[model samples]
Target: MVCGLLRPDAGSVHVTGRPVSTAAGPAKQLIGFVPQDVALYPDLSVRENLRFFGRLYRLPRRRLERRVDEVLDLVDLASRADDRVESLSGGMRRRLNIGAGLVHSPTLLVLDEPTVGVDPQSRHAILESVTRFGEEGMAVLYTTHYMEEAERLCDRVGIIDRGRLIAEGGPRELVQLVAERDRVRLTAVGDLSAYAEACRRLPRVEGVARGGDRGDVVELVVKDARSLLPDLLDLAHQQAVGIRSVEIDEPDLEAVFLHLTGTALRE
Candidate 1:
């Protein structure tokens, strides 16, 4: 709707002070969209792809050439500018995709899961580039199922579940809405269900569940996991649950997402 590709059924959509409709002339100029899939010609060089997009906005030859080079550098793809899209690594191609959206120097850059299938290194590069874009004052509408990404990158987030905006706030504010405690995860051998039940009875432990792939792990949400660890260990010993590993997780976007949606974000 913000792109004016699809009209809202009920309410209006706006971008950069312009109302979004089927014929959104000025609003379209201010918006840049980068979809999940690479929107580039595999047969074209990175520079060629960028030039192609720049020309779509009717950029002058001199300006388009300069913008293409600048965007290539912005995405850290300057060296790969002449390489064909098919010959580049997954990450490089993804970077080029982002570069294409930036050709017009848009006010609002919208990215949809830009790092979905890239290598860790490429993902890091893409994330860093995004951070810089925001730092430089670009209003980015980044959509991703990755909770950590939202937590780290967004100043404020509006969480949508089943097509509804269920929660909206800064990461810390959203997390505070659902949790006032840390979570302790214990991977152990034998009787995890019994251990979970026992853990639930402990003071300060608000919730407990048997989890993990083999059903050999116990998760506990507690007001203070460290302060309650000794009692947790003693009870595990009493229940004959041999502990293998322990992890303390602070509440984050994932917890908030689970709380509001009753399901994991990735699910």
Candidate 2:
């Protein structure tokens, strides 16, 4: 909707005082969109892909050439400028995806999960580029399910759940909003689903979700984690679930995220 590709169902979307749906050409020109999936020609070199996107914006030859080099360096893909999209690693391709968007030097860059499926190193690199973009006075609208990324990269966050804007605020502000809530993590075995549902009935426990690699972790958001530990242990025993360990203050933003949306904020 912000990109002017689709009309909003209600109200209006404006970009820099221009209506995105009505004045699409003018508004879209100021925006650069990077989707989650790779959207490049596998046969084309990194430089060629950037040049193609720049041309789509009708950028002048000289300006486009300079921006291409600048974007390559910006995304740390300058060394791989001649490498084809198919030859690049998952992380490298992710960086190039971002470079394609920056090729036009847009006023606002919209990144839709730019770090998805990338390596840890590449993810870190992409995050640094986002920081630099903001420092250089570019407006970046970054969308990610990870609250830690939002806390690190965004000055403002608007959490959308089930197509609704449930919360919007600064990272610290959002944290403080749910600060009173404590998180409990339990590593247990056997009948986890039944145990989770049983945990929900405990007083002052607001949210319950099963996590961990083997699905043996039970996470809960409660009014007071310290006081609720015994009840959780007792509930586990009653449910015939063996408790291996318990933890508190491990939930943070994710638990609050689950509490507000009634679903985990993950892909």
Candidate 3:
């Protein structure tokens, strides 16, 4: 909606003070949107794909050529300028998708899960480029399922669930909302449901559930995990649960999500 790709049912959308919903097309010039899927020509060369998009923005020839090279450098694809999109690896193609949107240098960049299917190296490169974009004065609205990415990149975050905006604030500010609690995960082998119920009755343990693909991990939200460690171990022993590992985490965005929505984010 912010990118003017979809119409908001109620309120109007705006970018750089321009009304995105009401404006015909000019408002979009101030924004660059890169969707989760790659958008590029398979047969086109890396530099060619960029030039094509730049020309659509009506960039002058000289400036278009210069911007193409600059974008390649920024996306770490300078050496693959002549490689066809189909010939590139999945990660490399993802980089070009981002570069295509950045050709005209819009003031607002909206990336919707830009690293969803890319390799780790490409994901890191994309995150680094986004940091550089903010450093260079571009406002970036990044959306992702990765909690750590949100914690690491965003200055402000708006969490949406069931098609509604439930929360919005700086990452630290949101995390501080749940600072009194801790997220704890215990890996063990036993009757998980009974163990989870047992943990819930323990003092300072606010919530408990069985998680993990095999439901072998007991997850809990506690006031202070360190103080309750001994008690948790005693309960596990009584329940005949063989503890394999334990992790106590400080409150973070995932905890904030579970606090607000009563469930984990779909990873």
Among all candidates shown, the one with the greatest lDDT: 3
User: How much is the lDDT of residue 159 in candidate 1?
Assistant: 94
Q: Which lDDT values do the candidates have, in the order given?
A: 0.84, 0.86, 0.88
Clashes of 1: 0
The Cα RMSD in angstroms, rounded to one decimal, for candidate 2 relative to the true structure is 1.5
True-structure lDDT of candidate 1: 0.84
Write one digit per residue (lDDT tens) for candidate 2, span 89-205.
Answer: 888888888889888889999999888778889999889989989999999999998878888899998888878898888777777766888888899999999999998888998
lDDT of 3 by residue, 34-65 (tens): 98999899999999999999988889999999
Model 2 per-residue lDDT at 65: 99
TM-score of each: 0.82, 0.95, 0.89
Cα RMSDs of all predictions? 3.6, 1.5, 2.4
**TM-score of model 1 (CA atoms):** 0.82
Cα error of candidate 3 at position 54, Å: 1.5
Which consecutive 10 residues in model 1 have the weakest lDDT in total? Answer: 258-267
Colliding pairs, model 3: none
